[model samples]
Target: MKSGPDDLAIHQKIQISRRTAGLLLGSCLVRPAKVLASADPLTNKIVVRSQLSAGDPGRLMNVFAKAYRGEPITLGVIGGSITVGAFATTKENSYAGRLLTWWRQQFPRCEVRMVNAGVGGTGSMYGALRAGKDLLSNTPDFVVIEFAVNDNWTDGEAFEGLVRQILAQPNLPAVLLLFMMWEKGGNDQEMQANVGAHYQLPMVSFRDALWPEMAAGRLNWSDYIVDTVHPTDAGHAAAARFITAMCNNARHADLAGRSGATSSLPSPLHSDAFEHIDWRDAAALDPHENQGWHLDFDDKGVAAWNAAAAAGRIAFDWSGTGLVAVFADPLLDPRRIRFRIDGASFQTLDTLKQPKRPILVLAQDLTPGRHIVELVDDDGGSGRAAGQQVRLIGIAGIGLKDDWRR
Candidate 1:
């Protein structure tokens, strides 16, 4: 709730603009002031700045109609830190929670279930790998995808692949693309916009709705943004407002009987090489030997391994052309591991740099076949020394063949 210098500057500019508007109107030199006050400024701006092209509601209208008649509906949200409610005081104050609240208010008679599948510091690459097990398992009737900021570190191909994977689900859920912004006004919303257009998905943009207000001094960045990237409680509320407004528009608009089916899916705008990705925890795989490793379970039921001693080996077989090893890269006193695939050259994965998050990946692309993978503790024969504790979390496979571990 502390206003920074930038907030002060914006406040001053807003006061000046208001004074000028009042003066111009007093002289009867401007349009009627009633027009400005007729609607909430933020809501009006959102409608005008909306980036929704191909405004077909598809099966979303049908789902809304069902909900209105007291049918059960599930809403799923997937993304990175923003979706995880990083800066929000609590998960209930996050945008996903706010949106769910609105849905409940709009359809009080319906049973609404919400699944928030958000992982911090990850992009579409990881999202694509985990969607099947994490988000799609809920069989959502409606899903909101928010990866604009996170996808900045990824390419359009990966982003498109994630979108396609969601759309291709057997449930044929109504998918909405949400583009969130950073405080410094940087995001990959435009890049993902191309993919949204290709699929004619309803796209809501927080940046498009709020950036203009911020620039014109009608809104201050500090009023909503908590940091350079994450949103505060008020910021999440604003995002929820924009998303709700978009959905309201879709509800009121004519549906034209368009079904949100994969049959209508257009050709991919970029390669969906990651469409077949799958994720598995290290503990889930049957290890060839326990050696110096032991499984540790977190409160959330996620399993990780502490390979504090050297020469720990765990072997598994997977049929995939490419593989990515996911592990814990601690911020303090990190460690390293030597990974060998089918007796290939040993590749050392060092966690010397501070990890932005607990999860990290070491990926490789190989020829398609059943391959053996082994991880060896490379702590220089020292056991749990200052920087010699390595933890293995999970692994993800890309373009896996039939014999791939399920």
Candidate 2:
């Protein structure tokens, strides 16, 4: 709600074009009348609802100051399906894409790169594990974090861990936490908001911006949400507007004499087990022994291992306490694999119920040292149905003691 003259000017300049308004109404699953009629009712309320967290103009001011100087920068977006543009007709209609467009318009002379690291159906748990390889590899200058809908109270530790990891980066990237809502009013915004307060980071809640209008009958759920979870193209536009307002507000913030804080690893609010995780595809492993295993190339251009028959196995040495096996979860019957660590008892992981890019933890928190791992085919002679097969895609490990080759 706090605003200055610059903020007002920025708001006045944000004009939603007729074509975008048409897209909002035309692409809606509901009737056009129901969406367009109520659109203006929530216009002013949107900006009022978007508030700066306890920490206004934190590191964001520094990023904007740099952009004002026309320096090239990279912005990274990391989250669940919403960040992945699930229900949006095209990538350009997604909130991330729209935000990039607005950024280009604001700083026409500066070069900006976009890095989207969203994975559908995954929460901050996997995001923290993959942040180093997937997102930070680009060395972004700013990062937008959105997992309020996907992360629950139980995952607060992982969520905070992700924040700490990003803040710990050498680049000292400006961080923004975004809270997206669900159709039935389900999300963990409060839990995430508490984490944001702990770190003094900026946060914007779409639920706060849109839900009140919906409850008061000024806006309907059909006006934005596509399904019960994902947002429609119009919904994405609204989200992009909220984020754009946030950035504009940041651009005009007063950070004249404040000294920026140094980037360092802070005391963790939750378990930071995934801070040093690394992933290696099956083809990347240097197997000391292999039997009955064949290299199968997938349509995605990934080389994976297929167990031709039972008892097929592969072995390797790793130096991590925690280990995770990544596999392709098919719709039909899937193959099973038995894993043994340091010659311990074998544990079988069934791929039948693991839908779409399933990852199972093989081991964790062992004494930090070199350990042997063996994987064996455990299909159990149950002949797969037609077009059913088990595939091993990759393995990821956390708390590695030594530098591992990719």
Candidate 3:
């Protein structure tokens, strides 16, 4: 695999914390391991394996046969916009659709049923609620859960809730957690896998698997994403390739025998920040490196306004970031709508800070690299502080660098 990102120091910290590191590494290196004790007919004692090397495509046909054994295999995909085929121009172009095509070719003699159960703007908490209808109702043989982009929308409670709901299913279907991305660099990979481990389920981390390829000038973010979170046609194809490879390697637990661009994550992942977030194990991320726009409320006191608070400020700085997206809401200031990113001057934009309404800000063509950003509120003459509750949603990081765009 290409050398890990330029941030070796950060992964070094992860390597030092052996326990967390081991799990993180396992999450990446030995992805989708068989649970051994599953009750699901398709998975029961079957274990999904990983490979460190890329091999022939023929092996994948065998992997599919082993997993299906000629019986009708039903696959259910659950997640946010990506799984729902958001930007895919045609149904046949979606990752799910492409996967179905592969399944049809691989198992022409056996029946394969595939279904899409993705909802836009929903997090894992909502995913859990819909599990009964989207996943369990169909009694799928395999279920793929995609929720990396939506994790930041809800608290950890909701994430775990989704995991528990799926693992608790009586059918005990073989479950694969697909941790997708919003921008090229936005997911908490280590934390995601830790949660997947809670249910002893296998995972497919598109971010960790794809990042190095993007970094080495072999892949690019735009090739995959149409907008911020949605994947374009090329992105779907790349995802399909990864799925095909994963199915090809499911039978080998050890990396000794495999082929075709094996995933590059080190075995046993860990990180200090992921620990603070309550994740059991996680793929390492650079703690010092900053991507996208990082904004946090520095003030201890939140302005409690019964109406739109006349202007608010959360001092923030950016460092040569590119193509970043911003989200804000009045969970903290609603009424007087519009906000600004203050540099030496304020760049005013509409920040629909309404109570419960999510405001999204897209700032493309950033000044090449690292820069600082400060959040500014504009109360515009209308003194409507309406239940003053201005809050900061979050930021998503997307990379437009030529190397990342492959």
The model with the greatest TM-score is 1
Number of residue pairs clashing in candidate 2, backbone atoms closer than 3 angstroms, sequence gap of 3 or more or interchain: 0
For residues 18-99, could you state the per-residue lDDT of candidate 1 as single tens digits? 3433332234313554575565455443443543442346657767877867999999999999998888888789999999
The C-alpha lDDT values of all candidates are 0.71, 0.71, 0.49
TM-score of 1: 0.80
Per-residue alpha-carbon lDDT of candidate 3 for residues 1-406, written as tens digits (9 for 90 to 100): 1334533543443233333323333455433545522422212111122211122223233335445567777777888888898899898898888888887786787788887888777666446544665677887756677788876644454466555555445545555666667665677545555554434444555665555556676567787777777888877765665565555345332333434122222222221111111110011112232223233342543222121234454443333223222233323333243333435555544343212434232343455444444444555543333433344433322222332321
- Cα distance off (Å), candidate 2, residue 18: 30
TM-score per candidate, chains pooled: 0.80, 0.79, 0.49
Ranking by lDDT: 2, 1, 3
Q: Which scores better on lDDT, 1 or 3?
A: 1
RMSD of each: 8.7, 8.9, 17.3
Error of 3 at 218 (Å): 3.6
Task: Give the better candidate number (2 or 3) by lDDT.
Answer: 2
Clashing pairs in 1: none
Give candidate 1's root-mean-square deviation (CA, Å): 8.7
Better candidate number, 1 or 3, judged by TM-score: 1
- Rate residue 65 of model 2 by lDDT: 74
